[model samples]
Target: MQKTNELSNLTKWLDQFPLFHSGDEVDEVRQKVGHIFVPHNLNVIGQEQHLSADMNHLNLENTSVNTLKYGAGVKITCDPFEKFLLIMLPMTGVMDAEVENGRVKACNDVAALINTSDPLSMNWGEHCNQLIIRVNKSLIERTCETLLGHPIKEDVKFASALDMSKGHNIYQSVIHMLATNPFLAESAKLYPLITKQLEHLLASSLLLNQQNQYTQKLLNPEKIITPLYIKKAEEYMNEKASEAITLQDVANNVGISLKTLHNGFQKYRNDTPKNYLKNLRLELVRKDLIAAKLEKSNTTVTEIALRWGFIHLSHFSESYFNKFGEYPSATLKN
Candidate 1:
């Protein structure tokens, strides 16, 4: 059957489920599936829901599953021991996910792998659509163990998110495989391929998470200030001096406390963060001034300074002389 047709059929089945019509009864249904008590409404149409013989296994009818409506928003509270991973591919709109520590915004073409055991909330905006798959944790772990040729750690969670662009491609491929090769879905022989893809997706997410985390650390001081963190912060300051920025903004981005950030920068650069940022701004202004000297030939010192976040002309002039051994006007004259 065509993928759309299959999904449509699945959606039909889900709509027929008693839980869909029973307003608050969906909570009971979810709780029975090992989720903690929470009030949320599910408006599913078509064959969006499916279950295998095993209670833990489920095949989300991708075709018939059109809109997975979350009445009070996409706030799903999971039981700690549920041991299920939810793979969600948002077809349209964006999803804002809030966890204990942080939040991330996920949009179309991206896949979010939510650990149902974790206390997290998802906010799905209007016009949003998605394909959701619920997989048993044991099944995934066993698949990973067999693929890696060893026992995988149970506690180490894969990235709870995946890049939509890459995920969309993978989702399409999976759907194609499942639709064209029904036997593969039935026999569980496709576990190897699934495992490999899952591993790759998780790895990608981890790398992205680390990169973002590292970036946040670099921009904030309360976080660890490694050499790389300092380097990245310096680079970012240099690149974004023209934009409206502040030390607090930098610190927040780096995920560090303000005091710790100052100390780290002082230790590494031997200068205060404000002073360092000022110098960077001055450097960019200097470059612009030098270029203007050749091009416009009449760009004033105040013009260049103000253009680069130097609000006070006297301070700008003093800093300019200290760094380059010449006042702004002197540079223009030379």
Candidate 2:
């Protein structure tokens, strides 16, 4: 049906759909489709309406479809659900989808899909338009298997929305076929093609997910430890332990944001940036103490600690004792 003439009809149809009206009902739907409902605009009359549909064959107990109409600056809220995958295609304008801690911007030529099995809220605005497909967990899993060589892990939170990139032309072809060919409503031959396209799209998304994981690993290696910055910071700490060193110094030397550095270290080392540096200095002191013992040489605990950035003799002694369960002098004797 023409988008304009079908707007009201589609709205009426959505109102009657099993999962559109109530929050509880939406939740049940999400368990099957993996998402909750949000409001959208359907203004495609004289001008082309940006047509987007959310479809879930598994969630609908077969197939369920929802249509949206949104304008500039308009807002809508969809109830959260567990295990939802939403595929959105915008026909016109641009759309920005925000979910939980992540966001994606999409234009007419692109489509975005976001997958989440946890409760989430989304906001779209500013000339945003879209088509959404909500697929069930099992169906998506199966589809992923067909597209990817291996199965998708259950815990992975797929994007709630994805913008088509390399697969844009393929996606557009599917959209055109769905929009113009009424025969698609009945022809069985189209099923294989549709499934194939879905597989391609899902595979592309899987790659994107892997890339995002790698990026996050690079950005946040562990507990404020980044691979790129850790070596630099460690070298600086070793050289300047006797001198005062601050997080800002390390961040500036490495040319990264303090927060980024902190997060990177946290991910890589499982410790705070400052703590890791301090531990490194303490390790140097311990090595020196042990080396003196091996050489049958004498080195004062105070001298070793101070050389390694421990300014307060007593405090250094306490920290050293706590770490190694012995006084620094004991280590020198060992």
Top of the candidates by TM-score: 1
Off by over 4 Å in 2: 1-66, 71-73, 118-120, 124-129, 146-152, 159-161, 165-172, 188-334
Best by lDDT: 1
User: Per-residue error at 41 for model 1, in Å?
Assistant: 10
Q: Which residue segments of model 1 deviate by more than 4 Å?
A: 1-67, 71-74, 79-82, 126-128, 166-172, 175-334
Q: Report the C-alpha displacement of residue 247, candidate 2, in angstroms.
A: 58
lDDT of each: 0.51, 0.50
TM-scores of the candidates in the order shown: 0.38, 0.37
**TM-score of candidate 1 to 2 decimals:** 0.38
Candidate 2 structure quality by residue, lDDT tens digits, 1-334: 1242332332343333333322223333334333344333222222323323233221222122344434433333344433345566654455556666566665554445555443333444534434455544444444443343233334345544443444533434443333333343344343644644543454344433534333353334334323767777767766776678798988898888999887876665545778767766877897888778667776787888877778888888887664444578776763
Q: After TM-score superposition, what is the CA distance of residue 79 in candidate 2 from its true location, in Å?
A: 4.8
Candidate 2's TM-score reads: 0.37
lDDT of 1 at 72: 30
